[model samples]
Target: MDKQNSRFRWVVFFSVLFTYLLMSSQRTAPGLITEQVMKDFDVTATTIGLLTSMQFFVYTSLQIPMGILADRFGPNFFLIIGAIVTGVGTIIYSLGTHEFVLFFARILTGIGDATIWVNLVLILGQWFKVKEFVRLIGFAGMTGSLGFLLATVPFSAWIDLLGWRAAFFSAGIALCLTGILLYIVLVKKPRQLFHNESVPVKDEIQPQNVRMLLKRIVSNRQAWALFFCHFGVVGVYVGFISSWAVPMG
Candidate 1:
């Protein structure tokens, strides 16, 4: 049972990993579609900026609330819903004939994208041992980097062959299928009871504690460096690789 459960946990890990890949791909897909989208909707450069920027905006603004909701409900719930919404949002974006509709589609995609990673952390915490958790996070980061990598050359070719609308819709269909698999497999896995037993739950946070936590992170030079490292490295990577790489290349 232990070995079987361990294998199953890894299965769950890959599922979430690929979902994270999808998240990364979705963020960058706008870059591939930028020129086509602009011509299709008859929008300006600023509007294209705003449209692509909306995903990050929704992702950044919702982190705190998403964490809270994940705590109250469950990480699995968010992962499933996020996948479904992401698919629906992509389909919506694919079908949009007007600028306003496309703008709203980006907002919807952002909302769905915002919920993914935090919940992934929670789900990983539940399934892996303490030491394994750190390694798993590194693996997740690597997968995310691959996502950034794949979003350009292959995705661009896909757009060329299928055209942007069909390409977006194909991804949406795949995402929805993955969401269904996630819902079926993890929700009722045979090892679910043991998985629940192994994972430790943290103490609930008081609203007031948020301030102290932020202050502590802010005061630490090491922590600040890490923040900037992520901002500089990951932020710049995503912005360029996902958004501008095709055009630049």
Candidate 2:
């Protein structure tokens, strides 16, 4: 039984890691194929800039709301839905030939990407104890970083060989399939899935009330500091990296 339990934990870890990598790949696809995007759309630098900005703009703006939704409806559901949406967006992006269609595609992708980090954190929290949160989060971060690393060089090569649209379509299919698999395999609450386990009562768990939680998060100085820290670091890195291929192409 102990060995089985240990195996189950490993399964959960790898499953989550694979899902995260898929999500990261989808998010970084645009960066890898920005040149193709410009050629296909026949757009100028300014337009491409706007479109790229739209990805981050929508994602950053919607994150708070996405987090709220993830809390109220379990991360598993949100993660699955987000992956589906992202897949659809990728399809749309592949089909787009015009600026408007591309804009819409980016928007959809942004919305889909917004749910990723929050949902991942939510899922991790359920599996790991609070004391282990930072370490687990760091591990997840490393996995995501590995995904990004792969996206930068190898994904670019794939774009060159496969053509951008084909690559996007392939990635979309992979993400959709992974999302379906995760939905089937993952349980948001262990107790809910394993009846023998003693689950904490509702009141014992943190409140799921969105407004109250937001109020607390917003009021906390440390939270704001952390938010800005994340924003600054991720924002600058993503911005530069997303635009790198554009000029090269």
Candidate 3:
């Protein structure tokens, strides 16, 4: 990689990392403020569960479609859309005064949140060598954990000081700004940055290709095993962490 291309890749890394951090924070922030939200909305715990569930439902349902779209259009396209949608959704949620509106907001947020993981992986593959990808992905996971931390202690403090609405409103604005930054700095692939003709670019996706990809993935027993494992472990862990843990504490 040329020095200019090399330096730009780190910028891409940090920008996308920030996007993931904000995504993680949004996922977990509601957990810590459950009681307050319940009181304000005159809602029961089950109602609050639905709020979290709405987000999760939309998020999980869209994963394969998001992956296909990211493959088709490039990760940066969806990243921009995701960031802005998340920001707007959060803003609406922050300003919401009714149950229906809140649910709608979560749904929007979920759609935006759905875009991150697949695209993040794709972008990493585009920018980094295979050896570096593993370490970078590990670091990305750690950054997500840091987002959980931000959503906990510091978020709690923000709620105490600024109120949850203001706290989330600020976060929404930050995400919107992040979207703009992504638009300015993010390229579809390294080809754009390095002017390297040898770098592979995505071809236009075809219906048959999509079907083949799906069919192959679906037929992979090992893939199914991994899917179930992730679904069971991460699903339960995220559910508990973002819904019950803080409230129970």
Using lDDT as the measure, which candidate wins?
3
TM-score of each: 0.87, 0.85, 0.88
Between candidates 1 and 3, the TM-score winner = 3
Q: Which segments of model 3 are wrong by more than 4 Å?
A: 1-5, 187-208, 247-249
Q: Superpose all Cα atoms of candidate 3 onto the true structure and report the RMSD in Å to 1 decimal.
A: 3.0
Per-residue C-alpha lDDT of model 2 across residues 8-99, encoded as one tens digit per residue? 65566678788778777666668776666677778787887787788778888988888777767778888778877777887888888788
Q: Quick one: ranking by lDDT, best first?
A: 3, 1, 2
| Alpha carbon lDDT of each predicted model | 0.80, 0.75, 0.85
Off by over 4 Å in 1: 1-5, 190-208, 247-249
Worst 10 contiguous positions by lDDT, candidate 3: 197-206
Clash totals for all models, in order? 0, 0, 0
Candidate 2: deviation at residue 222, Å? Answer: 2.7
What local lDDT score does residue 115 receive in model 3, on the 0 to 100 scale? 91
Question: Which of the numbered candidates is closest to the native, going by highest TM-score?
Answer: 3
Residue-by-residue lDDT tens digits, candidate 3, 1-249: 652248777888899999999987999788887887898999999999999889989998999899878877789889899999999999999999998999999999999999988999888877777788888999898888888888887888887789989999999999999988888777544447666545334633444577888899999999999999878997888788787778333
Write the candidate numbers in order of decreasing TM-score: 3, 1, 2
Q: For candidate 1, give the lDDT.
A: 0.80
Which ten contiguous residues of candidate 1 have the minimum total lDDT? 198-207
